[model samples]
Target: MRPDSCLSQVIGMTFDASVCDMFCAWGAGATLVVPARRELHRIVDYIVDRELSHWNSVPSALAIVEGLGQLVS
Candidate 1:
């Protein structure tokens, strides 16, 4: 089980995700995670493509995933 990082932030915060990742990386000192986009399909694709077992995201994300044919129960 891997925790794939989603680099999503408010509309004006472009570098916040990278900054957040930097902190998360510095605390552990490694790049075990990769940044992802905030788009509907892109976000869902990350979960499905990476085969992630767990995820925490906005309701829109789940709705998009469900609309795209949810494979999980």
Candidate 2:
């Protein structure tokens, strides 16, 4: 990702994926957007509205997004 990219910080701190999310974004000099718990229900919207360029999360979270019919093709 580019330095101007925005990365979604969706995974919890306890998860290893969160580490990757943070470090990757930092390494790339990208912005990291961390949504509040209340905002997670519409994470797809958050990602789109915030213009997030990268996302790193567990499979189940992705499944939820896919189930919502919001995962991009």
- TM values, all candidates: 0.38, 0.81
- lDDT tens digits, residue span 1-73, model 1: 2134433322224544445544554455433335344433456566566554434444566677677785468
The C-alpha local distance difference test score for the whole of candidate 1 amounts to 0.47
Tens digit per residue, CA lDDT, model 2, 5-71: 8988877887666788788889999999888888888878887888888777776888888999988
lDDT of each: 0.47, 0.83
Q: Which residue pairs clash within candidate 1?
A: none
- State, as a TM-score between 0 and 1, how close model 1 is to the true structure: 0.38
